[model samples]
Target chain A: MKPIIEISGISKRFRISHELQPYLNIRDRVSQIFSGKKATSTEEFWALKDITFSVEAGESIGIIGKNGAGKSTLLKILSKITPPSSGKIISRGRIASLLEVGTGFHPELTGRENIFLNGSILGMRKNEIQGKFDEIVDFSGVEKFLDTPLKHYSSGMQLRLAFAVAAFLEPEILIIDEVLAVGDAEFQKKCMGKMDEVSKSGRTILFVSHNMGAVSNLCSKAVLLRDGKIAMIDNSSKVVEQYLHDSVQMSGKRRKTISALDKSFTLQLPYWVNNAGEEIPSYSFGSDYKLRFDFEFHRELTFLNIGIAVMNKDGSRIFTSHSVDDKSFQSFSTYNGKMTFDAHLNIPDLAPGYYQVLFGVADEHTHDYVNASSEVEVILDIAETHKIKDGANGILWHTGQWKKVG
Target chain B: MEYEIKPAGRFSLNLSELWEYRELIFFFTWRDIKVKYKQTFFGAAWAVIQPLLLMVVFTVFFARNFTIESGNIPYPVFVFSGLLLWNVFANGLSNAGNSMVANANIIKKIYFPRLIIPISSILSAMVDFLISIIVYFCVLFFYGLQSTIPSILLMLPLSLLITLCTTLGAGSFLAALNVKYRDFRYVIPFLIQVLMFMTPIIYPVSTPDMEWVRTLLLLNPMTGAIDLIRSAVMQVPVNQTAVAMASVSSLLWLIIGISYFRRTEYYFADLA
Candidate 1:
């Protein structure tokens, strides 16, 4: 069977005016020819260069790219919003896209009419649309004001209605481009639920999002678009790992600095089971995250204290852990030896992102700092979008739930 | 097997595809109408007001002492008939010309036929035209104008068809050009003003006995349309020859305009 969406050797060239290019007035236009001056020169910019891909039926594909990566341009071509400058596209079925929510709702038309209007534009038959009308309204959660004109609806309300209509239509192929990132977390979950159902029903989906967590969760396979070309295409786990590595490098990675070893104190990560052993990649959230430290001592006595602070991407500490703070086990009294300190942590409550962590070893009296480290990228892949079927829990991992018996 | 790219870009006038999107056309047309009249104190009566004011101005200055040799019809009736056709023509033309540019966001982001933009703009003007027709009916009754029953009925659709043809031709033509040239906007309204008189809107084509002059005026398609409308309202016999002339000419212009529009429309998302 032929793939539902086939893109072959496609490319697009756009002629863009250079801002700094000098302009010639109409009177000067003729003078340039006689004066031997170049007039109206252009620069050809390839927005998408020689790209090809295909999606089989019932497949969910994620497209990830940085800015100017041609992710959106590729989707626009697939949806037939714009034609490619070269090559051909053979698509087997109707395509419904929600590049932006509530795209063409007339402010004057009531929510009810706009629904039908949007439905028809997405290529649903009138009678066919009428049957799903109530479901669309209910999913949108804008039923009470269905009779009111759409212009009066808030942006969120409009987005709700728009997304509900698009997702509910069940087109043979669906194209989504970063629109879901606008809605609140709850609505994103709701959309994720619907997308899950749609894919299960054997419709193809091409989703483009910068949010790596959403991509890895919702997509079975993924493509990393870089500089108008397919940089990589692999399973969600592999692609996400590569994407996060790229994200880590882009967010201004660690700068070269003098190690504070000559000072009274220093903090360094303890390497335990790194396969290559140079520096283990930072652990992700929800995984059994382990932070190991090589605790060193030059001259130490008794009652020594040390604490580990895990700060979010912005350096706000979610919570801190202390070795001395938790007692009844043991205390530190050492001389000069490198000892491994392993703090195994199951981090569940924190959101998925890059964060900073600092480990400091300090004492009660001398007021001397022993060690410190900063800017480690801990990428946490949130629970996958369709994890409920796999018996996965909610957004935040649960420690326990209470039950009452009367 | 891959074929070489052809520059003779195939015009996709897929009506069935448009039929699938019929609801969007209606919704957008509804959008234009609602936004047009909403919050205005005059309500939908503004439709009647605009043409009535133009009618009064034409009646006062142009009709007061003018005798331009209409086809045996009174001056006010002649001007009013012309105004009726011109109102629809002008309103539809302006609205459709700017519809594509005005809905730039939708045009760029969504996947709908950009052709629907101008077509819906023309459709929205029907509301105003229908309302003003009632006013025209009263004006005809008060003056005791002999309403040509057969001709009026037959020519109403004919006049509308001509108006639609002119609008689609001019509107689509301008809409594509407007994307490329911002300067066309300033030139358009001024051009419309000159076209109003050039089309014999306020006067008949020419004296009945002036053979060359009448023939010259017949070259204008709107001349045929306006003359047909006047002949209908004033209970005159049909001019099949002039209409045959106008229909052929107007249809040619329509084809030329749409073909030019199709050639340029592919670049709109980039240029606009």
Candidate 2:
């Protein structure tokens, strides 16, 4: 089978101008020419370099990397929204890209009108849009507001309408950026399902996203980019694992410095410690640990809640614990003085990786009393005494009884 | 259809590629026309009202004040015809000049013929031009006059076509420039104002005792078009020299405008 798209040694260079004014007026240009002062300076920034890749006719490939890794540049080149500074790309079929939702949606136009306008802008023919008009409206669930102007629709509704138009596009190749980062959870799930359906239909897809789970689930092949170069390309699961592992080392042990002042109080940065009250680099999953921070109160504060939240690298919260959760510390209060606060914790069965511990103080009633806060990242590793599977299929784990009922 | 994406050549104007995206130009034009009239009190009436009111003003200020030679045509009828074509040129120029910047969002997100943006602006102006044409005919009828020239109807569209060509050329040139140097945004309206006077819109090119000024005004592409419209509709003897000059100049401007636009369009995404 032949590849449907071929990219060879494509590179893009941008000249970063360091002029004080973003744009020049005729007077300034004329005066500068007479004065012979070529005051502007520019530096060359290569956004992509020698990015060679090819996709088979039915393959779904995920391009994953940190921000500024040239994923967007490559997509822009493929979509022909912008030209590459050098090299070339050859494709055998019509390619459409959804770099952003609602690319040409007019605010004053009705939802029904925007559907047609955005569809045409995305390279859909008039009859093609007409044929799918019903499906697109049904999918967006904006039937009642079809004639109402788009400005009145909630932002989420607008996004759904935009995505619905693109979803019905019958292009031979589809490239999508991180359009899934918005909208509600249910809508995101719907979008994911739609993408899954498109991938199964044997068209080519190139997806760029920070959602590792989505990438691993939907894509069979994954490419990792770093500093405008292809860092790795392999099976989706393997590449996802490597990216997760590398990200841990890349952001190693970031610490928040003590803030100078606040109206209510000031708190030192939080840190992880074990039973011995000594700081440790990491704590094994399921082990008892404590995160402690010292605070100096400026005035009497009653009914305060000190809480800590554990979040994954993607910033999704695993769980949260508040000091008030303990029966003994249900009504903790602080007076004008220095005091140390500690929250004891035990991690549940979670995937072994780095997690961020965000600790803050808040007034239980006002919620606005989160007058001071800080966060610290800590590593959670497998327990040395326990044996576990080499590779985990999901983010969580729980012990289940193994006696066979049969 | 297969596509090979590479660096654009210096002067590559791919008409076939433009042909493929022709529908987009229509869609863009529709959107512009819709948006321009939406939420307005007068809607398409504004199109007719604009040239109609301009004709009233010019007829009062210029026709009554000065004895302008307009052949057998009533001064008001002659001025309305000129205003009809001049509005198309002026509106088309300003709209196309700012079109790339106005549609910068679409240009950055999708790929189509960049020329479609300016072309659509010109098309939307044509919509208004058509409305104004209807008003012009009504005015001519009210004046109890009719074109004695048997081929006046045919020549009318021909002259309008020349006007369209000239506007497209000049508009695209300004549009491309506006994308890189947004200061052209300010220059466009001012340029249009100066150009209206330079063209023979309000005053006839055959005004007496101004031979040098008449020659300079005829050099303007629009002067030939407006003069042609007068001669064809008012049954004045056609100035063959002006008609020939306007056609060649319009073509030259079209070539120059589109080629300059083609050379600089690749950077529009970056600069706009």
Report the number of the highest-TM-score candidate: 2
Candidate topping DockQ: 2
lDDT of 2 by residue, B1-272 (tens): 67788976568889998999998989999999999999999899999889888888988998899878877778888888788888889999999999999999988888888999999999999999888877887887788765433455767877888898999999999999999889999999999899987887777787636788877776777888888778877666788888888888999999999999999888888777
DockQ each: 0.19, 0.75
Segments in model 1 whose C-alpha atoms lie over 4 Å from true places: A19-40, A251-406, B1-8, B207-216
Model 1 chain A: weakest 10-residue lDDT segment is A374-383
Candidate 2 lDDT at B198 equals 85
Q: lDDT of each structure?
A: 0.71, 0.82
Give model 1's clash tally.
8
Tens digits of lDDT, candidate 2, A344-363: 77666776665555555666
Clashes per model (N, Cα, C within 3 A): 8, 0
Across all candidates, the chain A TM-score values are: 0.63, 0.73
